[model samples]
Target: MATEGIEAVFIETHNWGKSVKFFQGLGYQLEFETDHNSGQLRNGDGPTLFIAEVPADRETPLQLVLKVADADAFEPGDGVEVVTPFEDTHFGTRLATVRDPDGRLWNLQAPAEDRS
Candidate 1:
């Protein structure tokens, strides 16, 4: 419940290249990129977006990262299902994932030094 506003969102695309290009036309630039699959884009300090290509049949969704005070304390409720428990991330953060009632997944995260 104690989280900052959403910091980023990942929108899985069946055609990752096209999505990236489309956003590029709108002035978004690559923030972090990987040739393997996914990349993040940013427009100033506003929320960044990550795009990735995945099989169309894959049921898993892209994530929406909500900055939280403590990812470990975020319990599942209000029609939400905890899919992954909080774990230390390589990017200096604590993270967990959950699915909302509408089937949208959200990634609960906290900065490394905030509260792991």
Candidate 2:
């Protein structure tokens, strides 16, 4: 896999405003937010951070998302477990999830190709 680097870190927060404020206090400027209580932020040239409100019944884990050249072509090495298969996301990207040896979840994303 031709991995680029960390793309974004996803954080699930119970209080969206508080979380946004906390990151803002740390110098991350809000780039954009969606109606569903999710936003992307960045501090300088650092990796982007994505914060979203967790649903009542779902527990969202802190996922480290890595940028890859092609999500469909990524294969986990030995001892790495595939949690979710790569699929096209509604947000215009391909995403897959994997579990590390320590049980941490990692998200892999590939930007959508231009159909035009």
Candidate 3:
């Protein structure tokens, strides 16, 4: 596995305020928040947490973010299926999705390539 381990956990919640509070209660510090009720939190040297607000009717599952050196150069080995190709995210990172053998989807994150 070329992955650099977990970078962050992507969490979707209908109650953004509650969710943010819950994580904060766990000792996570708010790093920065967006105007759209989404924010990132960090707890020491552990992986960061990204909380995003979603519609109540939306059924988004929690996703683990795997860090990679380069999203465009990532390779899904063996039984891993590529769910989504690497793409630019609104948060200024490159993201890709892959499904493991157990049918769980994971997000691969990498620093955005300098297009300059």
Candidate 4:
């Protein structure tokens, strides 16, 4: 499979409301929002998100999204928990997440950056 480019970064926030405001203060705009499990933001480039209501009970740290050439090359080890698998999204990309050895979460994505 061919790899794409960096798409976006998703930050799992315990409170999307405050996180959104914080990011907006940092010059990130609230591009879109939903009543459900997610929201989207932009910082003059692409979406750098602050998702709300991600349960604080999470066993991992903040979700850091990294744009990769191919998501298939990424595989989790024993310490890395695969919370989600790579799959097509409405946003036009394949995305996945895993907890690294240090309990840090990462969002590995395969998709081109949005120029819109």
C-alpha lDDT values of all predictions: 0.79, 0.86, 0.90, 0.68
lDDT digits (tens) for residues 8-105 of candidate 3: 99889898899989998999999999999999999999999999999989986798899999877777787888999989998799998898888888
| Each prediction's TM-score versus the true structure | 0.71, 0.82, 0.88, 0.58
- Superposed model 3: Cα runs more than 4 Å off: none
Could you tell me the lDDT of residue 18 within candidate 4? 81
Best by lDDT: 3
lDDT of 2 by residue, 26-114 (tens): 99999999999999999998789999998768886787789988766776677878898888899889888888888887888998766
Ranking by TM-score: 3, 2, 1, 4
Model 1 stretches with alpha carbons more than 4 Å out? 59-62, 70-83, 99-104, 113-116
Worst 10 residues of 3 by lDDT: 71-80
Best by TM-score: 3
* Residue pairs with clashing backbones, model 2: none
- What does candidate 1's lDDT look like per residue over 1-116, in tens digits? 65578878878888878888999999999887787678889988887897888898875466678877765565556766778878888767888888877887778887675643
Candidate 4 structure, TM-score to reference: 0.58
The order of the candidates by lDDT, greatest first, is 3, 2, 1, 4
Q: Could you tell me the lDDT of residue 113 within candidate 2?
A: 65
Error of 4 at 27 (Å): 0.9
Model 2: worst 10 consecutive residues (lDDT sum): 69-78
Model 1's TM-score against the true structure: 0.71
Candidate 4 regions with alpha-carbon error over 4 angstroms: 1-6, 56-60, 69-85, 97-105, 112-116
